[model samples]
Target: MAVGARLTPDVLELDPAAATDRIVAELRTIVGKTLRRRGAVLGISGGIDSSVTCALCARAFGPERVLGVLAPETDSETETLRLSHVVVSTFGVPYVVENITPILAAARCYERRDETVRELVPAFTSGWKLKVVLPDVVGNDLYRVLFLVVESPDGRQERHRLTAEQSLAIVAATNFKQRTRKMIEYYHADRLNYAVAGTPNRLEYDQGFFVKNGDGAADVKPIAHLYKTQVYRLAEYLGVPEEIRVRPPTTDTYSLPQSQEEFFFSLPYQKLDLCLYAHNHGLRAEAVADAVELSVADVERVFRDIEQKRRTTRSLHMSSRLVEPVAEIDLSDA
Candidate 1:
């Protein structure tokens, strides 16, 4: 079998028209017919995944039936709400803006996160910004270590290796933001009698990049099966605003501007996409390295990291466990 030489950039390309039609049809069936919901509700994050998911939703259920929700917190990028508006308008879907700053504040989300940061850097204060990142997987480092990056009020910056306890504290505090936003999403969904739509792409989904009971909880997920790159292709075909279509992927969950690659994926979406596709299709490391323009060693490292994340984050994909299985009625069949 040919190794990586046979793989090309177009390896994941699909007929956008067909993909859109299929997704829209399935969304209708799942959200409407099966879920017993009249419409769909999803948070628009000003990211490609959410934008494309919103547009597909508009096509599946009439624009009027789909509700686009914008839930931005204190640390959210300034451009997030603006770009989210662009998405809702371009798709002609109605949306509600729920500024979650007050909610986060009430829950002490910022306070707790800052307290943890201060434990590491005593000078951390109001004007300081921070983000947590992992070591570059594509580099010589084989071990994955999380580092804290903080920008001082006066523009100085520092990186510090976090203890496991410190990392857990900071992450646990930051999780309030996602859980809060998810609460709002569900509130709207319940009031509207619509299903909550999740926007995670295949890579994020497969790697467990979502918060449990937060972004991870959704009534229907339309784009979970598509690669990040494929989501971009669908964005273009669906007429997602050029601004959102071109914006780089971001966590937007951090106070400091953080790209999704630096924060989680470790590799840019394009390369990660190729590596993931190769691994899934049984492509060898040498072939993947050549296809993605990375060294063979880097490809192997990425493949290992992929498996590692799968093992570590497997619970994110699972439902609540019980001592014994409970059989439920199939409403669709009923």
Candidate 2:
């Protein structure tokens, strides 16, 4: 409930020109002084965060020093792959195409996900893509239920409540995607002695919209402090392809295309970004509702939902806890 009350309206909408300069400079500093690495490596998902992250890396380290790895699996959207290449070509960054379908198949991620989906919707077939969503939990509600939303090739959609077990199975399965991608990113980074760059914008990072030790793992998160709207503005200024720029935010992790809203957030990114900022700034729900044109109840729901997400996903922000030190190592040893 207390994310702090900071009046940061100007931070919500960025001046791309100034941002580019500051980010690029900060990137150079982080890369040169902090990471002690020659270059940076990242997975290019063709999303706004990935696009802007790569662009900043290119500016800081040059296209040659930035390696964009395109790791796509069977469930990934075609446009995501297509636009990934666009980003690499636009930035003239060196890249490698690594199809991860075989790896995912080996891991049985899709099979596990399918079995769980069929448990809920017996008619679920190969043509169906499933997305799990959680309803708003607010105001000391101890229990929060999860839901499963699926789409078929014929454009039919279904939504139903999911048992905790069903949700866990699906998540445990699909999470392999993020972990696998991170593995590939690290492989390349290790070979090149480069730091693994993270692509989470402020909204995703604050809301815990990443997987633990998966997409959540990064050597450096250059855009972790910028909101979603700011990331888009930076994308446009960085010359991200117009098609990619205008593409609606999506998970792109499922067989059927799904927007980020249907999968997670209740409101659109722009509105959500403002609401989140306002909430963080200690604005009352009624004031935020008037600003974003929603009812006070709805705004309060969003605020509480934000709190719920931050609470549940808190562990993803942490390192693995150890009960005790293996050997009381000294800090000066390193």
Candidate 3:
């Protein structure tokens, strides 16, 4: 299956308002049933989804009780930090900024400075080859390769490597950052007797767009059902900063300032989500194109992607199983 299959839709007809309302009601129940206090803890990335989640948390539990944690990696952009602060201030909630550079540095040192590069040796023939060199102090611990590709043009071949440590440092660095934030948030939540709020929306969740045990870990999720578009609407309703609501969403993991849509789908989120919704709900590709006013070819492409994602997600789900259940369980005569 292709990389972004999980993000495409089999059908394209989710009721955003109904989904948002249902999630809000569920969030309220979680606040009342799970949280002993009025405030909640959420990681605010300054993106629309997190901002919307934080806003909803504040609305449900009160602004004073909601604590927003801004966990920025060393390579995080200034704009992200600014937006995070904006959201926190808008809601009148307490906020904290924690940098995780030191932890990443330590992890790099433990793994050795040139681990990824060294691992690249087997993939290359024993000949003149190019490799990315790292500083001695950071070694291998500070850098991680996100992908390695061999490209050839007119018989001139080159191997290119992308590193999560340096190029996409925010990815690895921020994964730990998020996990650490959760740990701290959990501590604060325990002390304050509140719930730790999750900030992922349905778009991200359907795409499996989070680190499994990192940002995906949450005690309560305030905006899990809303799609990307619906989150923007709610953000407007809740008075989120205009800059944040209008800005394209980015993970801010790399120096290039890449958004999730650019990195994953190579299309705008608005277009991608619409295509996904139509395809996922069993709409004919032509019909979807008509509904969204997109080209038929585009809709067909999205259809193919959705089918791939369904197969891939199913495989992943099966592979993650730790124990095999009985192949056949007798249910008769129970």
Highest lDDT: give the candidate number.
Answer: 1
As for lDDT, the candidate ahead, 1 or 2, is 1
* Residues 185-218 of candidate 1: C-alpha lDDT, one tens digit per residue: 9999999999999999999999999999998989
Per-model TM against the reference? 0.96, 0.89, 0.71
Distance from true location, Cα of 205 in model 1, Å: 0.5
Count clashing residue pairs per candidate: 1, 0, 21
Find the candidate with the highest TM-score and give its number: 1
* Candidate 3 lDDT, 141-168, residue by residue in tens: 2422334332223333444466555434
lDDT score for residue 31 of model 3: 72
Model 2 worst lDDT window (10 residues): 1-10
Task: State the local distance difference test value for candidate 3.
Answer: 0.63
Error of 2 at 316 (Å): 0.4
> For each candidate, C-alpha RMSD in Å?
1.7, 3.6, 10.1
**Winner on lDDT (1 vs 3):** 1
User: In order, what lDDT does every prediction score?
Assistant: 0.90, 0.84, 0.63
What does candidate 2's lDDT look like per residue over 206-285, in tens digits? 99999998899988999998889888888888999888888899987877667877667757888788789887877887
Lowest summed lDDT window (length 10), candidate 3? 131-140
Q: What is the lDDT of candidate 2?
A: 0.84
